[model samples]
Target: MDEFEKIQKLIRLKKYETPGEQFVDEFVTAFRERQRAEMLKQPALSLLWESFRAWYDQLFSPRWTLAAAVVVIGFICGFAFMPRGGQTHLARRGKAPDHPAMTLSLGKDQTGKTLPAFSIETIRVMGEIEIEPDPGLLSKHFTGGYDQIVIVPHDEADTAIAVPYDFIHLDGKPDIR
Candidate 1:
């Protein structure tokens, strides 16, 4: 006979014997009992520990961990390097919006208040001035703003320029300005 015919004959004769129902039931019961015993042998973790483990699992889940990490890192970097108020203009290299909305030119036609003529020496002095407070706009001026002229020497040059030091805080203190 062929191999296929021989295999069919063996199947018809029930040559492959399985365990009896009683033995199967006993084996399953023993298995369950052993499993229960093994589980009972290990002590339960504390609520705090269990919660931390759960949180850690969720935080590191493969489907979301990378995206979540990127978002968290982005937020940290943005806030850490973000410029404070009133300094954003300086950070962007733009004119400060708080002071001097319009540039006054020499020889006014309507007001007739002859704008001071700009000279080369005066312009050089103006360039040395690090900060200038608007005396007209008290609200826009720095905190503790007052009329006090103090001359400070430039670090890079031998020239001494006058500026209100309180108005030129490097740390940008809003309360002091």
Candidate 2:
């Protein structure tokens, strides 16, 4: 017989082959039994991990995603807004700090020229300062909201010229460039 004819005969014979009726009926029962056996042998940690993984997968599932996200967000907001010990966050922030913001103690050096003394204590929230443009519908004398940058002289304040990020020389002539 030629290759094509031999292949056709083999396929025709294969069509008759099928699993017995008993296998189909017992498949679900057999699968459940195997799963139960596997679970029984699994360690506590493994079982906990599997449960957590399954729960995490379910939380992000399409049908439950919106509800789960809302619940998570609500919990976060609740914790953030809730007072700790005896003080609310806004209440604490509003209260005036115990220490002075800035203090300058003057002392004359050996040369008797007043030694430039400056102590500045500052806490800054790192963020981009947003300056919204003024439309100037009802314009004042000054174009901007603020009048000008007032620079106190060296004698009035311990002023010195330094680099852009002025860590050393705090009080100095303003860089207008």
Candidate 3:
């Protein structure tokens, strides 16, 4: 006989036996008992998990809490140090010059003309007029030969006058005040 056939014949003739029935029953019973114990502990484990989640939320629940605190503090500081209406703390500290008093008046002329009078300790003009367009022709309709005219107040004289009454060209230079 060949070596392979001999080995196969020996293996066939050998006895193959399973574990005893009592051992299998005991093992299964122990496994079932252990599984039951583990199942009984699941409720406690779930309770612990819920408690951990609650603790975490309590620790970090303030969304943007630091930012909110900073804004509130800033508001409090601003209100505490801000100037009141019509008055300034800087003025009280003498860091700024005192404002001068001013007076305004309106009177009528002998010819029944309304006149506006103003008096101020200090007067400043933020902007000045250069070439003023004609006020008389502002309401008139556009014509082919119509030219733009401007009225400017004379600094030396009290009355206002136009440089060119009819047709005048400005050299794009402002008149001296």
lDDT of each: 0.46, 0.48, 0.45
- The reply for model 1, stretches above 4 Å from the true place, is 1-15, 46-61, 70-177
* Tens-digit lDDT string for candidate 3 (49-124): 8789898668765776677778999989987875332233233343332443222233445697855433222212
Clashes (candidate 2): 0
Write out the backbone clash pairs for model 3: 132-150, 133-149, 133-150, 134-149
TM-score of 1: 0.33
Which portions of model 3 show Cα errors greater than 4 Å?
Answer: 9-15, 42-177
Off by over 4 Å in 2: 1-6, 61-102, 106-120, 123-177
lDDT of 1 at 75: 91
RMSD of each: 13.3, 15.3, 22.5
Candidate achieving the largest lDDT: 2
* Residue-level lDDT tens digits of model 1 in 1-177: 999999999888884576776998899999999988867765566555867889989778766878898999999998788533223323424444344322222343357665442211011112232323343432232122233322222355434343443233323323221
What lDDT does candidate 3 reach at residue 136?
39
Pitting candidate 2 against candidate 3, the one with the higher lDDT is 2
